[model samples]
Target chain A: MASVLPRTVQGPPVPLRWPPEDNRIPREIFTDPDLFRWEMDAVFTGPVWVLVGHEAEIPQPGDYKTLSVGAVPVIVVRGADGQVRVLVNACAHRGARVVEGPRGNVLKGGFRCIYHMWTYAPDGSLLGVSLPDDFPVEFRKEDYGLPRARVALYKGLIFASFHEQTPPLEEYLAELTQGMDRVLGDGRLRYLGSIKVIFRTNWKLYVENIYDGYHVTALHTGFQVVRLRSHGGQRLVPNYERNGHLWGQSRSTRREELQPVLRDMSLFDVRTKPTTDHNMMVVFPSGVVTDYFDTIQLRYVLPLAVDQTLIEFTFFARADDPEDVVRHRVRQGPAVLGPAGAITLEDAAALERVQQSSVARGDNVILKGTPKRFPPYRHVDEAPIRHFYQAYRRLIGVPVEEGTP
Target chain B: MNNADDLSVREQAARELLARYVRVVDDPDRVEEWPDLFADQAEYRVVTRENLEAGLPISVVCDDTKDRIMDRVTVIREFWGAGGRLEDRHYNQVRPRHVVGPVWTEPQEDGTVRVVANFVVWGTPTTDPAPRLLALGEYRDVVEFTARGPRFRSKWVVLDTPVLQDVFVYPL
Candidate 1:
């Protein structure tokens, strides 16, 4: 069992307390304008580093992709010098997005703005000007280059933080790093492809939903029909940590469980032995890495507002995988998860419904998974939510024991 | 003059094939009719807009062989999956470009047509009850002429929509 920190700290070890063991999460967190403002400053732009993407997504030199860190749009580009850099997507002049496309190669060693042709190098250094004589001598090209956010990479996952005072990426990840490394298989990954879906729910809701095994049987009834079940009973083996990360392990059910329901359950019976434990890891704030069978799925949850989130699911294959296997993975990719995926679609629908119902009720939704029977179980069982809210309360400078109205 | 007449006929056939494909997928009453558009050895895929625009060799939804397509359709149509409640419609526009390939002298025995056309598909959903646009993309097709006219040998949905609205259930 894990240990609980206090709600308030004086000097170094801040004691954090979990909220009251009630199912209801305050409705204010979802709809309040002030809370959203606080989160943008304290959570998204705070000490935690948000995972923008895997390094494999932009592999070659000049390759670039756009990502959103909270509301700030950023461009992750691989330069000609073979270094990956993250820069604010906004132009230095009028705040226009320098790169409009999702992912591409700049080809000319730098990116040129479409609006005014203001060019910049891959490392956010100013390259050249469209018209040199127009600006004054004081307008230094060095000063006009793209602005960069603090960037770090763990295994191949790249993370960026807007705040300079944020903790080091490794220190911030803590125990969550191990689970991320496991998903990467020690940095052996290739870009398969991705499916980006926009959902009408708070980003936190999506993150919380990832490790909540309790919703699988009830909300994801489609999985049961498709014969996708855990070998180990329905309950998930939860591993909670001090950094607010949770990793759940479940056994893959035998083929027989799926045979009765699915007409073509044999399609997945490709003589491949399941060597690794099926794992689901939720990184603090907004990243979920799930290893389903042999496939590695990474989901980056980006918040648009208190009520909107953009969920990007990227599927990966081993870099040395056979051509047929790669093709097979691609074919099976859309079938299991993502917006086009059978299982993911249900989750998306359920999330939207949950949002709507919660709005109608206008009250705190209760979390029943809180463990109260034994003190030992309290840390591992009910502590994740408590840990999360404690982190939230600390960041937002809210009093934890403030009673509900 | 003979070449012009042949080109016109081929172009008309391509247009007809695309129209039929769209009609089948958009039909609310007969959903299964859409799957019948493919031949026994047909292939289908749905790729991202970014990959399509960049001309990258990656697909978000890929069904290589007829057996694979059958397995996918069977799972969704028969087996209960997560995206069971979605009702979608594909509105496509096709443009035929002349290319030198095997000209069809007669209908093939395997019910396959041999033709190529560039197509664009716009998908809209009825579930949200607000008539929302789901996806927009281009389709590069390889059609075969069967005894019953023309069918798709392969259809790749090269999407151009920035973000997928929700989930894509059926083949495009």
Candidate 2:
């Protein structure tokens, strides 16, 4: 059956112009299936810490959530011992998916795979298997337990890495933690719920769109209607030499000062902060954290295919927030950032058009804040996108020009 | 009329309201009429089946009040540049076609009607030839008769597809 199948193509679809210019990106990266497959191996599974979920999501014992690390499905579960484990969802017996749902609690009987009634504990330890006498004598249940990634926690944010060479969470995060700390605010959050939407664009295009600051007022007309301009801020590429994580800090016009577009002005009201300062961050590859207005949102980007991506916009509020405040956060979070959000729907419209046109085959050049090809770019500049591709090319083993920055 | 006959008459009125709603939403030019379908005090929300079953309060779109519901119309036309507004046309112009059927209506004791129906919306963007499936959901609604006509007291769109395939420009 395999011999009759068409030969698989390796490497990029089109020959990459070697040692790419800092501001120019090859359009082929967004449309190539072969390159996307290679990225799953080199970038996602390689020495990289991917943000899976926050501790607040699965707070109770035996509470579990299913997410993917690149293309590999894994379960982020809280054990009875109060430990959060990231375990592969596939069963060891016949390679069946142990868990099926997005989230649930398994405190009662643990994860019992209906495929063969193989039961595993909350900690992913194999408890029992149906009719085990038929198995080989050398088969040890201990060795057959689900494979788990090296887990790390930073202010209740859970990160998992399959590669042993992945750096410490703090080191990988670096200066990005300052912005995260400002947004997290002591790291005690209550999970409200998440709205997942599929963006018709490459995963990189979706992630890099956050790093871009130039598109705020141009593409999103909602910003223009309210006359909200960045008062003062800078787009920071923390660990630009290695990680190229984006930490875009900005203070926009206050709600009262903005043009009254909506009757319910609570959408743009920033009551929690003394100023209208907010933080928007991308944790290297696929995690998006933002504190825009009173909304605390974390977006997990999962690539479905070369031109398709799944973005789960998870919202949160302070655990100690009053009832009204929690309600405010809940109402404000998705309305501004989710799929039907006032400012968010435009990005989907724009990125999908870009994805559809990438087959035209040309270099998409970065012009904003690219004169010097280095840091100190304006808050409204899209220069940080260059560093993003730099880090991406490094992981994909594409030779970037020396001193490109 | 007898009890059975009266109930059927109420259900028929509720069914007409549902049919009118799909027609109004399907036409992009008639978006302003969307809010008029609801009562003066109403709640409109779009939530996923997974989240709703888990007892989560968050939703994709939570217009919990009539004011908020009206505000959505403003956001769609003015902010999203749908109604020939003087702003950058953000959303691509798409013709929304709702395939709704197998509706059930029950007359309530409080003089309101409980309505339920399964619906799937197909979006044909002006730019693309292919029409995409925008949403697949069940509408759990409540209707109240007023001096003008029957209006929706509550409209809850429960999505069967947990992962939305695309961003909807208008209401489902």
Please give the DockQ score of every candidate, comma-separated. Answer: 0.28, 0.66
What's the lDDT for all of these models? 0.63, 0.87
TM-scores, each model vs. reference: 0.80, 0.95
Model 1: how far residue B70 lies from native, Å: 3.0
Across residues B1-172, which tens digit of lDDT does each residue of candidate 2 receive?
Answer: 8988878888888899999999999988888999999999999999999899988888999999888999998888777883355334435477899999789888998978899999999998877878999999899999998877989999999999989989998888
Off by over 4 Å in 2: A1-15, B1-6, B82-90
The deviation in Å at residue B9 for candidate 1 is 8.0
CA lDDT for candidate 2: 0.87
lDDT of 1 by residue, A302-344 (tens): 8887788888888887777888777666655556665766456
Let me know the DockQ for model 2: 0.66
Backbone collision tally, model 1 = 19
For candidate 2, the TM-score is 0.95
